[model samples]
Target: MSPAETALPDLVDSHCHLDFPDLVGELPEVIARARAAGVGRMVTICTRLKNEPAVRAIAEAHAPVFYAAGTHPMSAAEEPLATVGELVALARHPKFVGIGETGLDYHYTAESRAIQQVSLRLHIEAAQETGLPLIIHSRDADQDMEAILAEGMARKPYACVMHCFSSGPRLAEAALEMGFTLSISGIAAFPKSQELRDIFLRTPLDRLVLETDSPYLAPPPHRGKRNEPAYVAHTARALAPLFGLSLPEFAARTTANFDRLFPRAAGAQQAA
Candidate 1:
């Protein structure tokens, strides 16, 4: 099938770094491209609490663009850990719909485990306070990630999403058991990512979210270039056959998942 004829659904790029260098300078064009490509909505994820004003500005600049507030696990070492009050306060903004891009990562040695945990806990507390979902990123620390999330979820009920999920089935099972949603990224579209695709196919659509993790992980045909929200269409195409759903159906289901997790977005969608 030609790239454009793959029959993309009205997908959502649930996680992206639109505020980063590649797209920030031309957000108008970037968003236009995404809209043209049938991306119905997107979440410009936050990697640092301190940069939230910038994040909010981007979200506020355009319709269907929402912001998330939290520090990335790798950024925890460079940025000050977010406190519960700070995170809660930031997330209270109307344009802010979630708390995270935070979780565990041992992929890089730049951050210590202690710092990541502290930040993760604060973000979780913020999610509890604001009733927003928590976005999580984990790598090579499944045991610690599971333990910390288990501990935090015990304190209060809160929504959580394992963003850019690349963990084993055990971690996936645990996260699902704790009521956390699992987001599949464009990595699933790669030839070597069959295992990831297998897991994604097995995952229930009700608890599944599709993300591009844009400015990175662009799916096939655009795999080597910096990704944008528009490329999320590629993920939906890649996912269709695996799940036995038509493209439009896949899009509708994932978009529904997005709305369910971010109630504020659901409200906005309804009002619009």
Candidate 2:
């Protein structure tokens, strides 16, 4: 391995869509490439409850892959709104570790705001009831997201991570204070994302995790190309210098952060 290649530690793609056609068509190859790049585990995120079977199948078919069950805000109208009991039943599977990829996304469409709020609350209630961590996706709706999250936390405490955070410092601080972790994606590696990088730089490493949001936001040198789990290493490499740590150190810390935030997965790892 080249020095840079060797520098990659056993990393985790905390969020990815392996169920999507782009990567699903070549599942074995995708997993192999990720393995070659030192990705020890990957969580194939579910964007719709309707696809829960496929998502669960992907995780069941792979040794180091797990899955989450939730509806994405963008697809809220497409699937039935999740209930705490329904989501809890779905999460009973061995590899299921989280309750959502659900939250507000006002950038795309404002027409679904009410539906989005209802859907998001369902996922949050499920997380609280089951004690499973939530994986949230918020975009251009930070105020609504924070209000809803704060309200949810007040009802009952549950762990959650803000996936692909590209929000302002206020939202970041609010989420952090609520004990929510922040996950940085390949977007943080973009040139115009210095503001995001600065926000991440200020956050504690223990509350920071890494992801690719794959088949989507590939980091530098791979920008505009279809991203994959292997590219998460690049995101980690970018964060290493920002955090003043070696690549291995950053990977280890983020991996630990991922594990701590998703205790069910950690328990599964120990049992395995």
Candidate 3:
């Protein structure tokens, strides 16, 4: 075996889209590659609730994969609003690990902002009710995101993670204040992400996790290529140094953070 692969530590890809077209066609090979890279577990997200069955099937078929489902912010206007009961019902499945890939994204669908807010709150309620962590996707809507999340916390506390977090320091601080985690994606490894790196540097290591957001942010050495769970190892290698730890140490720490956020997946690991 290659030296790096031989010594690879177990790592979790906290967020990814294994059900998406780019990765789904090659699911078995993609999953095998992820395991080969020491990405021992992956949480494949279903952005639109209608696709939950297919996403769940992917998880059911793969021992190392788990899934979460919700309506994405950009699609909030077009899709039926998800109910707390509906999301909670999905949580009955042993492999369902979280409540969303939901939140606001004003970058492209600003006109749907209001509906997005409603959708986010509904997901929050689901998270609150299920005791599952909320997996958020915020983009160019930090202020409202902060307010709404804080508002939810005021009504009732719940666990949450800002998935593929590339927001400003203020949002990061707000999330941390609410005891939420910030998931690092390949964007943090880009040459131009020093500012983002500094934000992560300032954040507590325990309050962070790693994700590929694959089929999207591919990190270095493969930045322009289609990303998969296997590439999350590249991101881990790139960010470990920032936290003053070796790859294995960083991997262990982030995996622990992911476990804390997604206990259901951790439970699966223990069973195996």
Candidate 4:
């Protein structure tokens, strides 16, 4: 490894899309780069239930990679609704660590709001039943997202992390109030993300984790290009000072937060 890669603190990419085309064609190199940069683990998310098997295969083939399966909110209208039983069954996999990048995304598909809510609730129920953290992707529907999440908690508590949380403070506060975590992605490392950074600054360090959301939001030095897991270190490096932490200290805290939210992944790491 180069000096730069060697200097990176160990961290986890809590959410990414390794099975997606941009990364899948060069999976081994991508994973090797991640490890070289001290990204010790990653959770590749399956956005459609039909693609779970393929996503699972990626995790099984790579020691540091784990997987989660659910119907993404944006795809809810076109895809078949996921059954809670199905999600619970998938959670039985040793490497399957969380549920549903599922939640409301009314940004582009506002027409499908009703089905999106239905999908989000089903995913929440599965998280409640399986004891796995619910990985949420919310956008442009904060009111309904907050209300539904509250409704789920009212029925029964479940662990969750708001992935790529670039939403309003109200939603952030609501999720934190419900014992959920907020995942910091490369978006937080962008030059114009001061407002987003401010929101994270107010959040407790223990309630935060790190993700790449790759191949999507690559941080500075790689912005506007395809994102990869290794770039998560840049995000940690950028935000560490906000919490009065060194890079290693910030990485350790976020990795711990990830482990707390996704124990199965942590346990698997321990066993390995």
Candidate 5:
């Protein structure tokens, strides 16, 4: 049988994008499949400030779903910078467990470097104030990413996670040193990702979490297909042995890690 069909233990998809067109209309079915595959919980990340309402509603409508919203790095320049006050207010909602999937992304929009940096700092402030973990998306700009995160953290420490962590070892170490978490995505499960998997292996077990990054980065047997929370199993299975744990143990470890970083999620309200 293919990796996709491998049995999975109960898990939480620490990050996903159920608000995007790819999953929104089919949400109920999408969620059902996720549950069936042992993906018992998910945090749907909203990349744009403008779409917070829609994303929030998705969380409210589904009992197992929680949501977070912030300006994505790639869209930072096009959108207005976020403020700490605004984000803190949003965090009042019980299900708003995380802040910004906000970080540097020079891969596609290097021209917006200045604007992105400004936006990123603001999101950092928001996370600092709200006391919610910042969900970062670092890409080709590892140097700047490391510098800025360190600078902000120096001023005031805050919880953070390197969402979809796929950068070089330097950035990984920087994030890890700062007491931040590194999320494991399908990229870690890809056959050619020995280097990436090595980074995860070196990370402290307590600081690792799992995510699907749904509608993208599908794991083996599902790679190149639209990813969903259900496929998180394949990625989890790939890393379990590397950690010398059974799939159930790895799932529990990651899910417990998620609960620590996102306390609001475990006890979120049933409806909005």
Candidate 6:
């Protein structure tokens, strides 16, 4: 095939924080780099309920960007608990594609576990009602996370993705069993992340997605520096081989998985 016909496949950064300080100020250039790297789409997550406007504005302003919002687990105790009604209202926006970056995070704010559980359940309800995927950010709270998610699903089924997943095998299994997808982040590309990578390797391809979680996990070469959507290619580069596919093939699958989970983004991309 001619090189023109063999172009690299486009990928989506399924979860990121474009509203964060490390990225919000330099969006134009950051987005430009992402496009140049074949990362043609992104989902910027809003961790605080108060900042949803700013986050929504980024999605509205950027054609390739969509957004999600919820009160983060770490701040669950500090912020007013997010209401299902509020989140359902937010999802009415054309560019609002997902429900949360919410889940438990006992690693830092274990004291807020009770409120976090309440917030997570509310987000779950919003997702269930609105038919939007829930973007979860879990850390060091695997057992409770599993229980709460399972309980919530039993109460009312909803779609979900374990964003930037680095939890244990049991949690992974639980999420997969619950029909939740797992997003591979730059953390999976770290030198010592073989265990995490192994877990991913065992996951079904259709249940996999990819993200930068940018301004956080930058992958190799750019490790320790502020991450951007462009760096997702590096994480893809590392993960694709393990899946027994070239970068383009893996990109295509993960991008398709992303579109399947976040249909609004797919619709917006199609409309664009």
List TM-scores for all candidates, in order: 0.94, 0.95, 0.96, 0.96, 0.95, 0.97
lDDT per residue (tens digit) for residues 1-272 in model 3? 56754597778999999988999899989988888888999999999999999999999989999999999999999999999999999999999999999999999999999999999999999999999999999999999999999999999999999999999999999999999999999999999999999999999999999999989989989999999998888998999987888888899899988888999888455223
RMSD of 2: 2.3
Each model's lDDT: 0.86, 0.89, 0.93, 0.93, 0.90, 0.91
Worst 10 residues of 1 by lDDT: 263-272
1-272 per-residue lDDT for model 6 (tens digits): 76633785678999999999999999999998898888888999999989999999999898989999988899899898888899999999989999998999999999888899999989999999999999898999999999999999998889999999999999999999999999999999998999999999889999999999989989998999999999999999888889889888899899889889999888454222
Candidate 4 residue runs with Cα over 4 Å from true position: 1-7, 270-272
Worst 10 residues of 4 by lDDT: 263-272
Candidate number that wins on lDDT, 5 or 6: 6
Clashing pairs in 6: none
- Superposition error at 154 for model 5 (Å): 0.9
The runs of at least 3 residues in candidate 5 whose Cα sits more than 4 Å from the true structure, single-residue gaps closed, are 1-8, 267-272
Clashing pairs in 1: none
Model 5 TM-score relative to the real fold: 0.95
lDDT of 4 by residue, 1-272 (tens): 56643576969999999999999999999999998888999999999999999999999999999999999999999999999999999999999999989999989999999999999999999999999999999999999999999999999999999999999999999999999999999999888999999999999989999999999999998999999999999999999998888888899889988888998888455222
**Candidate 1: tens digits of C-alpha lDDT, residues 71-141:** 89988888987888888788768888888889888889434888888888888888888899999999999
Tell me the deviation in Å of residue 11 in model 5.
0.4
Pitting candidate 1 against candidate 3, the one with the higher TM-score is: 3
lDDT of 3: 0.93
Clash-forming residue pairs, model 5: none
Instruction: TM-score for candidate 3, please give it.
Output: 0.96
* Tens digits of per-residue lDDT for model 5, 1-272: 65633765869999999998889889989999998888889999999988999999998889999999889999988888888788888889988999978998899999999989998898899888888999999889999999999998999999999999999999999999999999999999999999999999889999999999998999998999999999998899889999999888899899888889998876443321
Model 3: residues with Cα > 4 Å off, grouped in runs? 1-6, 270-272
